[model samples]
Target: MRGLSWQIGLRYSMDRSGNQLVSFLSRLSMLGLILGVALLVVVLSVMNGFDQEMRSRILSLVPHITFQPWQQDRGDWQTLKAEVEQHPSVTAAAPFLQGNVMLIKGNAVEPSLLLGIDAAAERKVSRVGDFVDLGLLEGNREGLVLGDALAKKLGVEVGENISLGIPQSSDSNDVRFAKLPVLATVATGTELDQQLLLSSLETAARLLPSGQTLSLRVSIDDVFNAPRVAWELASVHGQDYIIRDWSQQFGNMYHAIQMSRKLVVIMLLAVVAVAIFNVVSTLVMVVNDKSADIAILRSQGASQGDILRIFLVYGAVIAGVGALAGGVLGVLLALGIGDIVAAIENALDMKLLQSDVYPINYLPSALRWGDIASVCGTAYVMSLVATLYPAWRASRMPPAEALRHG
Candidate 1:
């Protein structure tokens, strides 16, 4: 280290450019790094937030698995339930009636899916009890819970009577409707906000005017594995009934969330990569300006490999510093984005993001360690690679040629 002092000092001094042009380039490199990392972090965090929101909103409303009868009133109800309950994965089971019905209130008609569920047993599988506010389902057989958005659309409220009209199946064409009393309203964000309603299985079946057959609604301990478990249940029970997992029930929404996340990631990465190219160009210019010093070192026993490594190490250091700073900035921005947007919106006296219009009301973020680590590591690695060609060319310059040019 002592013997190499002069060379190290020379190299350090040569790095200090005497012009504002070089200063501007240095600032630009840092700026590019900052922008790249900040955007990457915030984008990934927002995607994570959206993904988490999807699961919370969707999973809370529906059961993990539904054992549907192949046809209405088609199978042995009690025996199938007993066989399905025997599976280790199945924690709770209850019979249900699923049918489409029309809601009629004083001449206004709206189509709605009528779900028949056992009041007491449905609680184990669905969050119907939490959704109920006024009338107890046990006391009233015709009681129903409407989604808040749906209720708004239909102009119905708690304790109001809404006639549920189930279309007659036979071609005989007798007009009949099942009139049910509204019990409560449920609020769950998403399209489910507008369509879903809850009612007793007895009421649902009665509304259908169809004979009751036990179509089981099952809840398993592991929700992510619901599809596999549902298939297992079907396999074990000989597939007499149609078994559906939550994934199948909400396939389109699930795929849309995944695609959105991927698209966001891709776009962010493309932006970051372009910014990183600025860092590459800046390092290349620095190498070009130091060619004479590099040649002198080559003459004084510094191997080509050592010169290459020294510049590579310097680039790595710069990248590491930039990445660390950018990551900190990103996390801070994400964590405070809600407050920041809220302040902006309040000052303007307008809503920036309305939940009714957008899925969420504010800028949501989730700063995950995995995403941060991946971004930082990738930036550092790219910076290191960016140094290679420039550093190699600097080290390979002939001493006679470099000194004459200088």
Candidate 2:
């Protein structure tokens, strides 16, 4: 009975002779499901890629945690750095001095965060050392390492001198200015390229009133655990110090990305659900058109359960084929989307992502099998559920009444 039902259901699904409208609607419903599932997969993969790129590019260069004195006077930074490094979660610690200042070159002026770092020590905590030769700032008190974007904006190049204007006090407008030569330029492919200025720890100390005591920048094994470790360090060895982490600086952006990803999932899932539900209309049309055939089958001793199973199989065939095709299309697109975007950018001779405005000037994609599986599975299940009402209606229709109507 099951084999007979399956064979008849498949034949009916393939037959387009009786009603052209029903066949067309069935194909349209399957097409909608395919498109919805494919788009969802591609979008989710891109979101995953963006999240990964942010962690690797921005978070890798920024300090995971920072410890600074609460008072204006510099504290014992060496002892603090050593203590931070002793923690099990801490990977490396480096000393740095930072100040908010303005850069001047000719008529152009830009605000920037002036960071002073010990080149060798910085290499342990940051990947900035890989981009620029921090060693150049060692003995050259007037040397600076500017982000490529900042240098371009200032119309300055390596060996060109730019003036650094540091405010004497937060309350007063008195500013101390010094001329420093650009030693090198670093391209980090992030927003840092717009407003970061790098110098030696000694030079940074000279620019600010805090002479010798520097703040410790710590890197940890797991970036997500930075807040807990920072608080622990603060409570134990930082009674006179303040604790800060990368989350304080970039948490909002990270959270925004996560929120957008979730919102996109919900919106796209609704689209998929709508497409799946379209199958209900298609199946209802099929049930009405096949009423006489169903009546004949019942007269031949086919049970109501057999009739229901036949339509269920018909719906499953449509959904299963669409899901499989969509998965294949989605996987191929996700795998090649990066190259496709790059080619489009090349042909258009334009940049979709500017490094100064966006992190890493390229569209990225990272396909996960789990996402594919979940999307396909959910779509198939929804499609099957949509078939239930129409299938039940067909199964319960009295054969005598159906034949009389036929």
Candidate 3:
């Protein structure tokens, strides 16, 4: 009967008292399968999390697209901003002036790039301002906002006066100097904290040399198609304007995430392959241990097809149980990874991801059903393949020879 094939295969895999080695091998194979699948799922989910953070946090802080005059300062920024938002793809636009300057707080002088922004308009295109508790440039003319790390380097605090020096190429070599107080110190937990200096556009107008060009920051509805959208905007704005996008500003990070994800998946798949290959060894030992029993079944009119089906079922059970357990475990781990990281951090009193080296200093993870399905499918296919050689050998065994040897 069909049920007899299933019964014999199941008994062979589970009969520990008769042959300890076969039972041990079966358990080892299942354990390997479980570990391999679980690891692949967790690693893939973490990569997915990183990709999401790249799009959400990093992309939100930077401009999806930027447009600037190739010739000189675009004094009519108000007009340009309005024109940019008219496009269906363009969601928001803001004006910004940026230049290099030296910051001086007593003897602690640091080189910095100062960004002059319209407080109200800048908020439309970027959430960098929201990361901080205080408005570093709000209502404070001739005041500066220092990034947390920059503030630490300067050894200064809010309401402290800092001097800014700009290079002035006059008839004689003279640098223009202006003094402004620190409006606020902000910790964005991004690379922006390293060398950012924020000031109101009006303050920058007085502090920097005359004729500094302003660049337009633009946000788009479709982030992935930013380059194409930016090019379209540039075409309408005229050829004299140059455009840049987040892809250029933060592409290395995005590309690294993608490349790492591909490489890791490949490596883990190999691990899964190795684990799956162990199924062959497991089935071989099971067939050997059950040779006499197999011969008995043959003598009792069991067909070769029945013998093959039995072993196949045995291997499938190992693979199916292992895969199901692993998939469940991996999803649970990935979803609760943030809490795990927090617990570890609290116990060790140390930070895992440093903000200076990474985009954000927190653990992020996401689990997708598609990834789990792939892991399970790969396991099932490999397990089925591993059973073929052993199952075939058992099916072709001569009942007389197997009986004589027994």
**The best candidate in terms of lDDT:** 2
In model 3, where do residues sit more than 4 Å from their true spots? 73-75, 104-109, 133-136, 140-142, 153-155, 158-163, 169-173, 177-179, 345-350
- Candidate 3 clashes between residue pairs 3 or more apart in a chain or in different chains: none
Best by TM-score: 2
Could you give candidate 1's per-residue lDDT for residues 1-406 as a string of tens digits? 3336444534542455544565577567767787788888888888787777656655756888877666665787788778878888888888877776888877677888877777788777766566564235565457788877788878888888888767666575655766667878877555566777888766676667556566888888777888789878878664567778888867666677679888987887777777678777776776666677777877887877777776666566567767888888988888988788889999999987654555555666778999999998888788768768876776687878878775
Selected candidate, larger lDDT, 1 vs 2: 2
Residue 5 of model 3 has an lDDT of 88
Query: Considering TM-score, which of the candidate structures 1 and 3 is the better prediction for this target?
Result: 3
Query: For model 3, where is the 10-residue window of minimal lDDT?
Result: 132-141
lDDT of 3 by residue, 1-406 (tens): 7998899777766667877877887888889888888888899989999898888777887889987788665547778888888999888888888777899888899999888888888888888767753355666567888888889888999888888887754354678888888888878666678777889887876777788777788988879999889778868876757888888878888999999999999999888888888888878888887889888999999999999989888887888888898788888888888899989999999988877788777788888899889988887787778778988988898998888766
**Candidate 2 on 5-37: residue-level lDDT in tens?**
999889888888879999999999999989889
Q: Would you list the C-alpha lDDT of every candidate in the order shown?
A: 0.74, 0.87, 0.82
Q: TM-scores across all candidates?
A: 0.81, 0.91, 0.91
**Candidate 1 Cα errors over 4 Å, as ranges:** 1-17, 54-57, 74-76, 105-109, 128-135, 170-173, 178-181, 236-239, 290-310, 336-364, 398-406
